[model samples]
Target: MSVVETLLVFAVIPLAIVLLFAVLTLLPGRAKKARYKPGQPWQYQPVWWEPHPLHGPAAGNHDDGPKAIGSSVYQEPQAIGSGHGSASHGATSHGSTSHGATAHGATSHGATAVGASAAQPAPVSAGPLGGARGTW
Candidate 1:
């Protein structure tokens, strides 16, 4: 084969291919970066970037009442008589022991109605020692 033809086949073709790839890399296409508002949620964020925990006024579409699309659903604390929950009753109660029922009295078998006041154990009165710490 002629030197020109051989050079064209081996060098010219590979050089053209490399130039074409370079041009394509520099071309501005539809793959533009998505810009997110500061402190707002983003589809892709850097590892160091932390979004705000609480939603701001411009965070999301809150037009539908107080609920937001991505915000957590907040529930008001249930009242004592709401029958929804016993959160106001302090610690959880087990077995049967209603209000006004003393701890010793409720020790009887098969009891119910353990009310809010009776569920919690009575706090011990501080003694003269004032909770002294012992080594052993």
Candidate 2:
């Protein structure tokens, strides 16, 4: 065969086949679908599915209304020096002194240590709170 015919048979046919495949693969994705744009009112119907249909609002059980699920209530901020243990403040404990004994008064060497209270926790501190906060 001539050089021009051989080139056309090998290169041109394969390139045409590849271009045809690429166009066929990408054609379906080019079709437009419903899309949401910012500031535009949503036009689609909202759908909600509950695994337990009888317990949800769809079962005509609207007495309780829509209850907040896993919602947090707004709590009043406490004074920094209030010294009260509220939801926002955690109880701070001072140093705990425990000898070489377990909660059952048993020593490390299997001997009991009399008057040892390892089960009791350390007392909470009444001093001013101390912590640091920062932002970058």
Candidate 3:
């Protein structure tokens, strides 16, 4: 064969191989599954850094969001009611009043006022009057 023909054949063979591989890879199911690949069931098999005796990731770490006392869930500044393990000051965006307003009881998004004599309600008075007074 002529030198040019032989060289073309050599180069073409590898190029064809690479192009074939590229095409197959671009074709669905070769890597991540798509809707067209009906034969394959796409599943995300999570590899555990360690065995999960409790199943899923352990309770903390990347456990959704900031771990707090009452609620658990991550959410945006506005959507704090969904339950994703994050904490919110729960104060309204505008600095106003929480009066006659059930702050952290269920009316608000788990938010208590800054001086809310409730949330951090006098860690000193879990005693006689919900921390109101000494006696009746």
Residue-level lDDT of model 2, residues 6-40, one tens digit each, is 99999999999999999999997884976756777
lDDT, candidates in the order shown: 0.38, 0.38, 0.39
Model 1 pairs in collision: 97-114, 98-113, 98-114, 98-115, 99-115
Q: Rank the candidates by TM-score, best first.
A: 2, 3, 1
lDDT score at residue 130, model 2, on the 0-100 scale: 89
What's model 3's lDDT at 112?
41
Q: What ranking emerges by lDDT with the best candidate at the front?
A: 3, 2, 1
lDDT (tens digit, per residue) of candidate 3 on 20-119: 9998888765646355555665574221122233432234333232223332332222223422212235433443233232222222344542433323
TM values, all candidates: 0.22, 0.25, 0.23
TM-score of 3: 0.23
> lDDT tens digits, residues 5-119, model 1?
9999999999999999988887866448766557767654111212334653246433322212123222222232222111222121432223332321121113322343333
- Evaluate model 1: give its TM-score: 0.22
- After superposition, the stretches of candidate 3 with alpha carbons farther than 4 Å from their true spots are 26-75, 79-136
Instruction: Please say which candidate is ahead in TM-score: 1 or 3.
Output: 3
Q: Which stretches of candidate 2 lie over 4 Å from their true place?
A: 31-136
